[model samples]
Target chain A: MKTVDARGFSCPEPVLRTRNALKTLPAGEELEVLVETVTSRENVRRFALTQKCEVSFDETEDGFRLIIRKP
Target chain B: MSDRFTRFFASRWGIVLTGAVIGLLASLLQKAGNPPNMGICVACFERDIAGALGLHRAAVVQYIRPEIIAFVLGSTLAALFFREFKPRAGSAPIVRFILGVFAMIGALAFLGCPWRALLRLAGGDLNAIVGLAGLVIGITIGVWFLKQGYTLGRSYPVPASVGWIMPVLMVGLLLLLLFQPQFSEGGAIFFSESGPGSLHAAVWISLGAGLIIGFLAQRTRFCTMGSIRDVILMGDTHLISGVGALVVIAFIVNLIFGQVHFGFAAQPVAHSNHLWNFLGMVLAGLAFALAGGCPGRQLFLSGEGDGDSAVFVLGMITGAAFSHNFSLAGSPDKLVDGALVVGGISTYGQAAVILGILVCLVLGFTLRERFE
Candidate 1:
């Protein structure tokens, strides 16, 4: 598993970074995305799903940690 | 560590507090000297700055607003402090610039932006209802475009200097403001002797307000367009709660200051022409949606090194100049026989607005990836 720390970037940036990270993520691998706001968390999940990646997220005390599995 | 403080500001309550503070500060700014119900309008302030720089010849509205300058500088400070200042660009800059141009045209047509719309409604201006309805309609349409997988493409990391452009430009503006220089007598840098341009809070107070707002808005990622977009797209009310708090707190403060005037007619710096008011905001809302943030948000993003957003801000300044030069901006209605008539945009403005809508729809349709 690899992690992308997008905790402070605003909306769409985090999503874009997630997509960039998943580009070379190889099949059947998981990527963890840390985000600081609820909006970023949801936006990243939505964007990841559009890329055909399975996505789930857990609420952290500060924000959220999204687990994306590439298909 | 400052993480605990960061967590609180990022929380639901924290956002609400941020909105509340903005509401209170805006009201006080108005009391101090800003235009009525326009203590913090991004579009109007930017237009004034354009006039001040001789971008347009609108004499009654020429002044380099410190609040505008401080917004970028303040956001730069916050981004640096939080280690969030990542310089990046290359996300369809031309398209974002066009969106910014159209957004300004629409906003000037209505004489307000989304923030001003909310503040107007809070101040008991009934015309805002029509404008806000237009905003919702535009946002809903943009939501549809998003549902269809519209994106402006990806932005990549660039050199740190790229992000410093906006802040440096802001510093230059501040110096020009302080020095009040003239290349020749009555040439270049201009200032309004009367009208809304001359009316403003003390420079220090305005700077303080902009700094506080810039800092909090950066930390919380506060955006008026995003608030409406989130609700329509995902049933998320996280951002709207802050927006709600803004209206509520501002309304209370306005009432305390005796600034609440409820009417469709006779509003300051606004028009009563319902149709243009509605249509103008429709264009602005759509532009905000398609471009990914409102005018103020764009300024904040530029401060943090988003070059795409910086292009959008430049587009807006250019649009303001175009609007006044072409008589496309709306004027307030004349009060006749104790009755206020409707002030509407010029025919050219109407045409520009219609054309802008077409452009936005075209952009929305063309800028999406095929998900197969």
Candidate 2:
């Protein structure tokens, strides 16, 4: 699993970073995106789903950990 | 995010800070000769630009605003820098143009765009509350259409040359400004001697500010309509925060500069009719949402070579003309009481807004894709 820390960043930027990271992501591997804002968390989750990745999330004290498994 | 400055600039707080800086600078511009509480209104500026072009004879709002020209040119530069300039067109051009018209009508009725509304509120104009509410309500209505899968249809690629047309026009407008000929009855341009048309920052300052805003907005995709739409459609608050900061900071700045005199009546470039302010923005907001962007967004899109958005921009210019010519525009310090402003749309504006909204609703229902 590769971790992408998008915490503290505003949206679209985080979403953009996630897309860039996913392009080089290996198939059948897992990725984690950490986001503080619920908006970013939801956006990253939605974006991962759009890319055919299986998505789950863990809400932590700081923010959210979005677990994405590449298809 | 690796670079320290990039990380800082792209951070959430950084966006908020940037928005604050813009608010502060906007206030300074107003103090430095821009219209009160109107440092950078895309609709109003475009309308002024239209007047400068002799598209309309509205003397009060006629000026060749260099900022308007800078916005498109700056965005073009950024687009080329990022290799994101793709020229395309043919997404219901007529509908977009009509929407742009209504958007201007609605804005003129209120005498402000979304950005101006926020600035007005921040400057202690209570009437803006109604306008802001109308905006949210209008956007909420637009979200309903989105839920129904409404779309403006897809755009197709065109020759790259087509993308240069809008920018070329902008350059032409600039050249006309550089060589200001005496104003004749039907000259190439019209320059306002006084009134809101005449109030402006130094040409270089205005252009520089416009250029910076254009480039930053392009890179960040900063849009007032999109911010509200995203909140409704995706529960995203990212852009909204930036907007909130703009309002808050502007309010504080206004206070510091003694521009904060709180009252509903006698606001700069704004009227006292609460109902029209609400309905006018309702019309403008719905039009913006239906058109898929705000006036500023349309300009930015035009900069990036979107022919559809360029058409919309032209439509707005035409609409601004109709607004003044047809008495659809509302005015400050001119209190015409007792239905003087029809249905809160200032006489003819109400009719146009109603018709525009009805068209948008109809288009919303008709443009949806079939699920079967």
lDDT scores in order: 0.87, 0.79
For residues B118-228, write the lDDT of model 2, one tens digit per residue: 888888888888998999888888777766656676566679999999989999888888887666756747888888989999888888888887776666566788789
The alpha-carbon RMSD over the true interface for every model, in angstroms, is 6.5, 12.4
Q: State the lDDT at B92 in candidate 2.
A: 84
Docking class of 1: incorrect
Per-prediction count of colliding residue pairs? Answer: 0, 2
TM-score for each candidate, following the candidate numbering: 0.89, 0.82
- Quote the true-contact fraction of every model: 0.00, 0.00
DockQ of each: 0.13, 0.06
In terms of lDDT, model 1 sits at 0.87
Clashing residue pairs, backbone N/CA/C < 3 A, model 2: B276-B344, B342-B347
Stretches off by above 4 angstroms in model 1 are A1-65, A68-71
